[model samples]
Target: MKRALILAALVLGLGGAGWWYASQRDATGAEADPPTVAVTRGTVERTVLASGVIEAGTLVPVGARVSGQIETLAVELGQKVKAGDLVAVIDSLDQQNEVLKARADLAQIEAQQASNAASIREAELALDRTRQLNRTDLASTQALEAAEATLAVRQAEARALAAQRDRAQVALASAELALERTRITAPVGGTVVAIVTDEGETLNASAETPTIVKIADLERMVVKAEISEADVIRVKPGQTATLTLLGDPSTAFEATLRFVEPAPPGIAQNDAAETTEAVFFNGLLDVENPDGLLRIGMTVQVSILLERASDVLTVPSLVVSRGDGGRSTVRVWDPASRTATEREVRTGIDNAVTVEIVEGLAEGELVVAARDSDTASAAVTMRGRRSVFGF
Candidate 1:
């Protein structure tokens, strides 16, 4: 009786222990299988991310070559203009006076030239008369010499006058050009984005040309993307890119990368190593803005496409284990055996979110995305497909 009783107690204790162990496993969610996601077919793109700004492809600043008070502002801000269109007019009273002075100087020189010519003619006639008289012995040699001297003086005067006339003509042309410069015109066809000098404002262009207005071609734009030095090596000209404006992020603007600067903007080649700050190179991309929605100085998100794979078997990048030998492996799940098998896979493109499986994977086959932990096995999302596991 004692032996049977001891056996019964041992059996009861074993049963209770098993029940407690099973209940604890279920309560902690350790009894649940690991989260698995099916291999999906989708597009995978490898891109370099960057931040950029939208700028006019062709930006030109209209300035005044001659300094004066701005007399008229022809166009307002946001006004569209064509090349050579009148942008602004400066006060031309002083320039007009200068032109008049030049004209007067030219006229005086011309009159002097005419008078010199007349005097030369008279001297030549007198010299000829003296030469004839001397040939006949009617005039002294002194008279002939004096007449020749007078003729030479008059010819020399004519030459001097000719030089003066040339000088005056050049002065007149310069004055006219100065006057024309008072009328500022657009150098390129674009929209007026800025007005630096308003009407009635005095501009001092003696040291540097003062800008009157800013114009930009809004029909097409260039995105100046700042790519880090680490990523600049992968970017190249003629690569396709996509831009999303901060204001309109839902719409993607397609662009073509025009060029990537060899060095950072405003940083000289020799000074690159002198600064401890992070360096970034500019990548230029051309985008068409037919609707005129893109504005200058607008912020943009840039993505430069480096590689792409279409309709390929893909899985979450987290599930992939990479070894030092460049071998990639994944844990494939078998529903019938309730076990996961580790298998090697060839990966084509990895964009971090999804990785393309080139070999050793098939569609509809489940792969362990995360280990069976209370926190990890609850949910797994890959390429818009969600897997939910129950404890």
Candidate 2:
């Protein structure tokens, strides 16, 4: 009888412990239910961010026109220069020798031409005298014909000498022009962006590589911003854009879109495969750097405003849940009891943080962002028991 009583007591204790453990688990789940959100209203902005470099609107790469050794560089990188200013001088000795040879050849041809002219005149006079003598029967017919033939030959030789003189003069002018090219000059009024060739460097202008210097007009600058194909269609010429320098974030320069490239430049040769599928369209923004604050290749951030909306009802994106069949739903809170109710909504123009709610929700209304499922079930069961047991 004592063993029977002990076994019964142990079974009852075990049953009580099992019931307590289940009760504790249910209580823990119930405490986790209520969803919370703070309702507020303010303004939000939509923006696209991209990084790009600052570039001069007018950039010119100066190059040596003639192949020669660089004698001296009058300017260095970042030097301000004016149009027609001499930047560097090449060794003009070879060019000078060429010019002298051309001139000497020209002078020799001119002297020969003078002699040829005098001989032609003398031959013509001889021919006339012979004809007169022949008419009077004082000269032989053969002598008269020989004099005429000499006159014709002398005239042809004079014409040939004149042509040679003209050719020699052209050669001299060409040599002089080539000599002038040895002195490199700035073509436009600007700052020297780079000096490619240093003093004593041998430049081979005939070997297909040509540029020696780079000059840019820095008074005005352009922001060549790349816009993705998706956003490019919305952008157009004359649209207002704001440019912000990378290091300087406190200030922004205002500009207008000057142009949009119809096709990307050098797209076929680009080896970056990730960006290959992203067709980038270029947009030009014109800004005046009057203080000379902008420099070539300086990075800049650009913002182009596409559209705007004013005084619209909006909600936090987390509260707007995507439902079945592509429907957008939201959890609306009851103002009287602070209880959440699922409601279908229409949304538009979402900026990722907040969404524009067109219908089914009003301003200043609280919305639930997902409640703990276990807590919600426990709360529902508690309410059901209270109703059923009349407590």
- Encode model 1's per-residue lDDT on 1-391: one tens digit a residue: 9967977776675566556445535556565566799999999999999999998988888899998999899999999999899999999999999999999999999999889989999999999999999999999999999999999999999999999899999999999999999999999998999988899999999999999899999999999999998899998999999999887899998999999987677566575453478888899999999998888899999999999999999999999989888999999999888889999999999999999999999999999987333432222222134323211
- TM-score, predicted candidate 1 vs. hidden true structure: 0.82
The per-model lDDT (C-alpha) reads 0.88, 0.79
Please report the TM-score between candidate 2 and the true structure. Answer: 0.70
Name the lDDT value of residue 333 in candidate 2: 71
Q: Give the C-alpha lDDT of model 1.
A: 0.88
Off by over 4 Å in 1: 1-33, 266-272, 371-391
Root-mean-square deviation of each candidate, in angstroms? 8.9, 8.0
* Per-model TM-score versus the true fold: 0.82, 0.70
Cα shift from native, residue 282, model 2 (Å): 3.0
Judge candidate 1 at residue 294 and give its lDDT. 87
Tens-digit per-residue lDDT, 53-74, candidate 2: 6789888988888888988899
